[model samples]
Target: MKKVKHTVKLLGALVSSVVILSACGNAEGIYDDKGQVFRKVITQDMSSLDTAKVTDNVSFDKFNQVYEGLYTAGKSDKVEPGVATGEPEVTNGGKTWTIHLRKNAKWSNGDPVTAHDFEFAWKRVLDPNTAAEYAYIMYDLKNAEAVNMGKKDVNTLGVKALDDYTLRFELTKPIPYYKEMLAFGTFLPQNEKIVKKYGERYGTSEDKSVYNGPFKVKDWAVEDKIILVKNNEYWDKQAVKLDKVNYKVLKDSQAGASLYDTESVDDTTITSEQVEKYKDDVALKKRIMPATFYLKLNQGQVPELKNQHMRLALAQAINKEDYVNSVLNNGSAVTDGFTAKGTADAPNGKDFTSQIKSPLKYDVKKAKENYEKAKKELGKDKFTMTLNTDDTPSSKISAEFIKSQIETTLPGITIKIKQFPFKQRIAREQSENYEISLSGWAPDYPDPMTFLKIMTTGNTSNNTGWGNKKYDELLKKANGELLQNAEARNQTLIEAEELLLNEAPVAPIYQKGEAHLTNPQVKGLHYHNMGGDTSLKYTYIDKSIDRKTGKKKTK
Candidate 1:
């Protein structure tokens, strides 16, 4: 990682608006009522802005606006063109993808964005020294896994830039969701010169990198605020409605709602308390997010957690039904599996949740029996474990509730709650530094594999240090031999999840249901349950709202 001096400074005037691929891609036409400012509240501090290193939703949202990938996730999760010209030319039974880059796409620094940028960025994610946690997401690419494992050269990865505009990549197998995968922040392009120049410091600040998307970073103050202004050099600048995007960090959901009530922010994700307060409010939109929050036992970090009896005891001690109903007043519901409820459909046209049956439940008697067995095995009469979670109000409440439940149900067990800022909590989890951590996953794609693959033996995301050979074998078949057979693949995933849950590697808590108080005037705010939270590029404030001073806005 050494500094490079060659910055692609393509000195010229701005280009015309780039061509959008399809109608469902977005709402076409300039907005007459679009406001100059759009304000929003975030629950956590950003982790990273570099596409190769970004793993959090907040950073992913920023990455989506500042750096264009080969494709963009459009309205209703539709695959939309970003730097890509149009639909890619597929060949070799979908194993190969040949895409043409839009020549008009330019970075904020006036560099003509080229295929080479994508080639460098993808390879960088796999570079051993870079230590990218999401590199496993690209394991579908030929030689990508081997490169990340340090067994093969990164250049051997089956991706190439035929020229300035043409980019091609070969997959080890036909990925049905390849187009959707390309829309992820991990695949976003980067300027090699800027990256090499910044070295390890890339994405830490605003000036370290350049932007090629709808907006550019005007300023970024760590844990304080991030201000993004319109990227006039962007190819689709004309279509970008907001002149400025303001993201303020407010971990307290109640404070966020207060901001919304005061009209200081256009949107805020409310907590369960606020959900109850705004039960009849029209502005409070309840959505069952395509995400799951669960309890993960760190087998490597704690020896007792490796015991099936202890794990089962931990899993069965807490009542998910009560937790979701009382603790999470949001639209969340008890979940038995890690895969979300609405993510993918099974062969019988049911969601993955309805198909998997696990033995996990909140039975006080069975939980006590398992604890006795664990104590017998460990030769200990008493045990204590720490529960790690984010410092957000919602997470703190969840942890406290879980702690109280587990301690009351199991006589000799004590639970300690360790709260860290969101990003620090993620860092500690990835490093396997906690006993039992409250973890959540929002799917990167619509497929069941997006939820299932994270539990693979050596995956960077498998922070639990829980692994099963049989589980891995089923996933292997699902990804390989069953790629063509949808029914078989679906069944395989169900079986895999059942096996994993029954073993108590992790306890399925609840599927998140987000309740957000949004200004009625916010229009075309492209949002999905997965990936980034929202695309500010498409969001516009259409009109003013005179919110009631002290109560939830009913209008």
Candidate 2:
């Protein structure tokens, strides 16, 4: 790893060449001598800026910059105040949550942001017409499910705007993890006027949405390039030093590496081959992200997958270690539980995986036996199934590897592979149209419940149609009684996870690992443990000072 020379003129010229600079001037104060331009490449274009409808990591990352939630997770994975003044006041055993907003907060449009904005956002998200994939996240709110199901009127929902600066939320249960859930983008505020004006076009393009966070999106052409400019009207604009952030969508890893090599892009992720070429580069950094890649078994569509023995056998047959090492080559580790490895501690200060039985042992003999039983039960000569995946290179490779392993392990089973565009694949998976779909989960908050409770009987994310009364009971206890008592809560969550593992509803594959190639000239950039986009609110590129200090240290 070698340090490179930093030059403001050269970097500024490079960034300006890629994006149109609407209003340009010299950086002020500490950044007067340092340039304000930075560049990076995104793997996919953001599908929508509507926080409620976003489901994928790309959309989550982009929307995070444009919206500000009541609370946000800091680098330490602890809940921190964002739009709120401080910790919310909880009364009536968590049924009532009162939040006080910061007076200085304002939308990018110069409209004073109020607590009513959040009320509008939450109601819209839970509305049945919205069809938000993450709508289940708000089920804890009183009457939310009923409202979403059209059983109750929207006005009956529990959130109310108390004047312009205060908001109160009423929940159906005593949810201890409620505060953390507020940090999710789904809890961010939205402007009712803007949404109505754009109608269906809202959040589909850069001009269709409003921003209240530290940055504003610009020039967002799908599959092309997107840009983020510092929001001058942001409440914390003083801390946002980077004037502009540029993101180019490069689907090809080799092309991304070339862009980094040619200095066309300031930062990019490397593939396995590129790792060997640039592992020694000073800019290379790796992180273990809080995400789990898994194979979703569509029990509603595939009768064979409905057999617990067959699902367990399929889980044992696929080799996760091989996929992590051969395919990812990025530092991803094998996942045995739904919760990510490095996520926050459970109530008992114990690892979440320790509480669950490991479902990831390799057993070819058992797989064959289960397949035989499945064939007999189905009254068919052969057991055949199709695995659906996205068109990404990594997904294709993973799908092929799984296909080969299943074909080799199960003598009479024939596996077909189908790959579609990322968006189309999401639609298919949502419709329960595939026998097995490759999908992943990145936690919206730090709680273990965030992972385990999302697949209950009628959860919106329960695409598998998996329902167990006992499992649901455990989840209910964990969410209600256990949350109030920390020790009890941890034990209950562990028990619930074990139940899910035994049922084999979803096959755990590998936790994700992220690698980025940052420019030596870029400073103050950090990756969030949760799989949201990079936060550039406090990030800046200083060329006049040492890269390590970003300023002249005084004796």
Candidate 3:
């Protein structure tokens, strides 16, 4: 890979303001009680900010604010050009893309961001040694899979820099969603010089990285708080109104709600208990995210999980509607399919979920019959299993609910709930260390492939230890050979999803709908379902509005 000219510049002291800049005009910080510029609570501390390596959403919350990709997600999660001046010039029957990068884009260090940076970043992720979990996302690139699998060298990847400001990409097939994929974190560019300078330390701390996005990390106190100040060098900094955004880590929702009530934070997520308490509050809000929560049964730990009857029995025993409406009074809804509803609309404007027949439902009789069959096959009168979940208040409550439901429905099962911190829980699940683990997935992109492809054979996110050769073949055809045929690809993905639900490797629980509170003084805080975590660029604290009434305060 060719290296671009690297320049390092000193970052002088950032101008301090006790109050926000004139952009907020006469308005004061809504959470100004703490002398904060802007404030919000993160449910979990960030895991990593390295775009190429980080996999969790909290880490993405930081990464998405500090990095800009060739394309950026716009309002409503549409793909918009960022570093790239416009949509790529396509040729070779959609197999080749020529992107003209904006020459004005510069790194936080005043180094010019160029096409070579993208080439370097893409190849770095594709390098097997990087161990990036999202490496499979780039498999559409010619030789990407081969390179990541060690069958070919990283240099053989189909991306190249035509010059300082132009990039070319060669694809294995015509991906209609290719532009949207570019907006994802894995495709974001990195300054080769900074990466090489920091090596292992890159992105580990606030100052260890270079930023090209709307905001840069000012300070990060691990597990306590992260401070982000506006990046003046960003290409679109003119639109960034907030001088700073502070993310404080708070895992307890009740504590967060109390803070929100006292105006200590600008935003906080609420638990089911608080949902009814704040139901009449004018600031209470709800949003349905393009995310799904599920149970990952570790077939590797318990071979009985591999039995269709056993898996179905467990899935059928849970009353999903009651779980959503009663247990989780949040905006969540019961989902019968793995892919959440409203995620994708078919060609005729019908929802994708509407086209499929769900194999999952709450039927105690069916569950008992299946359980009997499973017991007969395994020759076991009773068994004890562990249910693993995160330590958050909501996770604990939900885990307890699930345990009660399952044990009551299935006569011979004893469930013990084991709780770990969010990050630790993810690690345990990734290692396939538990019998049944509660898991959730927020799609990296809008396409169904983001949700569907995770279950493919050997995919990193498939912690269930489930695989079907036919399922893999169908997905391969949907994403590759049938890439250009929308009708064919849709049907193929539908078939694959049906097979997955029928096998019940992982049981779909609910699509996430967050019922939370936001300070009315904070404006322009948008929830983008298909994009990276919300950026504070356009968000501002408008103190002129009455906090309780959400109306303009009159003198």
Candidate 4:
């Protein structure tokens, strides 16, 4: 493992006791030296940079800068070329894909990036010993399931390195959206040598990983600041204007906002309260993210949650509008269905809400009646449930609001809120140890199937244990027969989603919106719809220009 040292500046700490600091003033801005672009992002702690095991947005955002996948999402949320030079060619009726890589790409260590790196990375992720949370994301690849379950040797996996720059993939079926899946982080390559050198420490911290993308990690201390510097070995280095990127870890929104206000940081997201104060600022910008915040009922932990009436009552008891407008004051919009609006390529090119029955609107009368029916069905004198959430300020507020609403709307129903740190909350969620869990989903790709297919019976992400055999059948059909026919595939997906909503396995809440402030001098910063790090490959600070040479330089 290569350890890179960096200088850091201490930002103010919050009451939560998390280390908040900035990583600027190192090597004097890359833009100042070489006319490169740079961005300063504010985030909570970055748990890890291992793409396969990463779940938090903060970690993913930073990791994205340090890695690249075969495909990537473009400005229009459509599939675009990344490491690969062009779109993959389907040779055997979509079951087999041939990918031609760009010869010029290289890793940060100057090693030629090749197809073999992908093959090695995919096999490592699916190995049962890896225990990656997103392993199921690749189960569509031929033999991936068998390999993951230890029924097949890793050598039998579908991906193959035909040569130094040519790769092939065999899919279990003809999936039209398969190209979109390749854009996900799990598909990013890993340096086998680096992994072997670090062994157990591989990807546990910043020192253990190597860069193969737009940036490289530097000066990363857990719960503190992590810095990213541009990869000069990148194939498109000439196009990448960013020299150095800095991230400040601050859990409190107020403290983060203060950093942005004082010009100590380049950009930071704002809460609802801060939105009102900063909306008029010239730097404020709004982005509609493809995320759905919802509640997960743990039927395994609480039997009452298994009862259909209790689930329906609980769904109706909370007011989504109030939650979005009051609790999440930052521009979030209440969603009538699980999928957010504006998501492209939906069934019939229509929003998911358009195809579903009217959602369980907020009605105390309906909630109370259902609560009574639940008590009667359970044959209990009283019913009690606990809601689990992360200890973040936004999560705490959201949990408390739901608790108050449920207690006030439904009589004889007692609810408790349990707050845990982010790590503990993730552990409990994975173990199914909570009666109810507050969770959110940010799309890994552009397609609706990414969000819709996770509820299947055997999916690793289906920790809620919510499964419908018919829904699974529809998804399989979509992945196999209907995928090549886009229209047919979308219709099948619509049916699957309708079934999911009718079952009410997960209560849909609202589509999230982000409020953030950026320095006006920061030019060419692009926002990614998928919740990864913002890309600055084409960005640069527009300092004064050289009049004779038509060149720009930092002022």
Candidate 5:
């Protein structure tokens, strides 16, 4: 199954430790040689540049810079044409779409960016042996599911290259956001020649990948630094102003922010602990990311989590409002459902959050009552569970908060906290090595299925081993037969969420909000609440702006 933009697991857990590096030929927030060079610190290192293999937001961010798909996320989250001329022409009752690609588009290696590139990329990912974790994201394509499950041949897959510049896709159902889905990283076209040559080394380093997007990898010093230079051979090179994009993989937020203070970098996301220091600073920027930071209770590891009352008690024991306003202090939105607000909308075109009642709201009395019932059911008055989290400052704080809340509300319940590095935590989650884990997910697309599909029985992304047949059936129906009726589909999704929350396989704590410091000269560094998080394609530096005065300079 597809992993969350896992934003915008650790979207709230931003930055890990830093190896302070000198400026990359930049002066006063501007590159000395090429003023368009943009420098910033990233939360994590890019896992892979191979579009088929990536399962994290950090990789997705770099993918956005180096690849172009049928569609791309423009500034302000607007959908714009990348290789394709525009949206596809709907036919065969909206199941089949024919897209016209830009004939002039070429990869960094000078190969024509053709329809076959996309077809090859899609088929490669759906191939069962490829073992792509995000193969489910492309399940909307006809036969994509069967192909990924090893039940069908890759050639039978719905996507086809009609010619050199035109591509066609046959969907299992008519998807209204199908155009937007193509803009996703999984859908980005890959160079067939480069993949064949590089083999296992493909996209592992700067030399192994070719780009058709605005930038190409200039240098990649894994876990140290990554530098992307503008793709001169790109179809629309004029639109890309930045000559270089520099990213330093840092573990701590304060070190990054300090670099920003020294005018060595452009922007850095501040940690929760540092929020107090920059609460009133002029350069401080805050945004409530559309993401859910939640607890994934591993029923397989801890048999008690399988109990509905135990899950309910855990859900009700915490005060979400206090956690958001006090602990986070970054304008995070509180919700009881897995699907974050502004993620999807109802058939009536209203916010989905507005139409439903939150089933997991906090109530100490309910928590206590449920706790007693859980104790009786288990015939135990005392229990202990370990909570897993990353080593980031934010993750540490959140773990302590949850441990306190559960232990305080339910007496005799001992909670142990264990921390691992960011990637190590994901490894433990996949292996089911802990009782409870604090993780997060951001939408890959603007649909309920993006969030809902993870929890279905046996989805790899479903770190929690909790599954209910009814909940799975509801999602299947909503995304299947109910696609024709938006209202009915919305209702079905809502029911599924309510049912799942009653079991609390993964109880949501709060929507993630980001607090950071950005250079005044930086413009169009858009942070998306949905898929891709942020794209640097439209991000440019305005040299006319004075660094200190926050005003444009004039002759």
Candidate 6:
């Protein structure tokens, strides 16, 4: 279901003991002699690298480096051509696009990349038998919906390979961000031979998959480390200076920081508890992303959550500003709406957040009044439920803060706090085992649709079991008939968000911010708020030495 980046769930109550790992700095080359090797840490093991199956950021980050799509995101979020030679030839009123492939593009195995690869990859994702979680991303293509629903043959899909180096796609309507969307990993191509050979074991480990980008997976030790080396056969190998890159998996936040401090790792993300410690450090960098950390209220499990007033009461009871400033003192911002700022703006240059009419606000008196009304409507003065969340230190603190705020604002409500491992939490959510769960979402694209489309009827990611026919109709038009009119499309998304707000399927908490400590010697690191934040194609280590002084260049 394209799990949210940085979101996890713990299995049970928090354990007071914190284990420190014994230093293996010597056994593992903390820093290679070449000075061209870079190291980083990941909290969780990667899920997959196959274009059609990979859903989470941990896997997508590596995929972004090892796979090339039609376009690739570079510095400042620029969409640069990858497999495509140049910008597409748009015709037929922006519905038809013809792309010329780059002649020099080659896979790691030295095979030439062709237009047929794209056709096969796209059709495979849309095929109902594949059951891909991200197949909905292609619904804008002609007949893609019918094909995915098993009502039409996969061959009827919009994409086709005109020749060995030419590809064409017929879209249902003009997409304003078509080029940007193509840069996403979901649009990447796959070799048919490799897929058939690996079968179910594809992308399970390093040796199972093939590479076509700047880097290739050299080794993957599950739950330990993933090692990547430069793809010497890549089209642009000269630009990739890094000889090798290592990603170590360490679940403990403190251990990650220690690795960075001891020169064992080049960079690592910092938890909220360590934010203050690094606030004054020069290497500390804070990135405010277009993501929202919120709670998914499962109305299917507890019918009381279905009441609009009950949901509204829960949403209004919390002080979002406090949650961001106090609970998440890591540079996050309070958000009253689901979509975060910096993702999109209106045609007139106004931000999307400024145009929306807020449906909920913070007011203790109003919250109490709504709570009373909900109690009366439900015919129960006392209500009890569980609030599930991850066992991370920050998540535990945030859940406790939310519980306190809601309990103080509403009367006769008993809440049980349950923590689970991140993976188990996702399993329970899919099973509908919890009434409410702390959840978050990161946008797949810059368009508002990335944030609004999830709650549509029957969307696999909509774990809340919420649906509205009117909302779905608005979204369908926004992606179709309203495509040509920017203002109208913007208005439709606003209206759709208003409906979501009124229904109150999720409580908006705060937009997230990333805090990381990077070694100064590591240079050219680029990031964007949306999709695959890290891009290492142009990134290189500044390992130059002064010829006369014999001193290394300072970062």
TM-score of each: 0.91, 0.89, 0.93, 0.89, 0.92, 0.91
> In candidate 5, what are the lDDT values of residues 411-465, reduced to their tens digit?
8788899988777787788778888988888888888888889999988789788
For model 3, residues 1-555, the per-residue Cα lDDT tens digits are 001001000100011121123213423433443322567877788877678877777777676788899998776787889899997999999999999999889999999999999999999999999888889999999999999999999999999999999999999988887898898888999999999999988888888989999898888888777888889899888898888887767666666676666666778888776799899998799888878889899899988898889999999889898899877888898887898876787767798888888777788998899999999999996988899998766677788788888899998899899988887888888778889999888877767788899999889899888999999999988887787778888899899999999999988888988887888888877566765567566778788889888899999
Q: Of the pair 2 and 4, which is ahead by lDDT?
A: 2
Q: Write the per-residue lDDT of candidate 2 for residues 157-259, one digit (tens) a residue.
A: 9999998999999998877667878878788899899999998899888899899998998778787778888888899898888888777775555556665
Kindly give the number of clashing pairs for every candidate.
0, 1, 0, 3, 7, 10
Residue ranges of candidate 5 with Cα displaced over 4 Å:
1-34
Residues 1-555 of candidate 1: C-alpha lDDT, one tens digit per residue: 001101101100011011112111323211111357777777787787778887888788778778888899888888889899899999999899999999999999999999999999999999888899999999989999999999999999999999999999999999888899999889888999999999999988899999998999988888867888899999988898888888877666766666565456777787665687887776788778878888989999889888898888888888998888877777888877788987877778777788888777788898899989998999997888899998765676778789888889887888998999988888898888888899888988878889888998987888888889999999999999899999888889989988888888888888888788877777788887668877878777655443433233455
RMSD in angstroms, candidate 6? 4.7
lDDT of 4: 0.74
Q: Which ten-residue region of model 6 has the weakest summed lDDT?
A: 11-20
lDDT by residue for model 6 (279-379), tens: 77766878898888788999999899988899999989999887777667777888878888888888889878778876666778878888989999999
Candidates 1 and 2, the one with greater lDDT: 1
Q: Between 5 and 6, whose TM-score is larger?
A: 5
Q: Using alpha carbons, what is the TM-score of model 4?
A: 0.89
lDDT of 1: 0.82
Error of 6 at 149 (Å): 0.5
**Candidate RMSDs in order:** 10.8, 6.5, 9.1, 6.4, 4.9, 4.7
Each candidate's lDDT (Cα)?
0.82, 0.77, 0.82, 0.74, 0.83, 0.81
Better of 2 and 3 by lDDT: 3
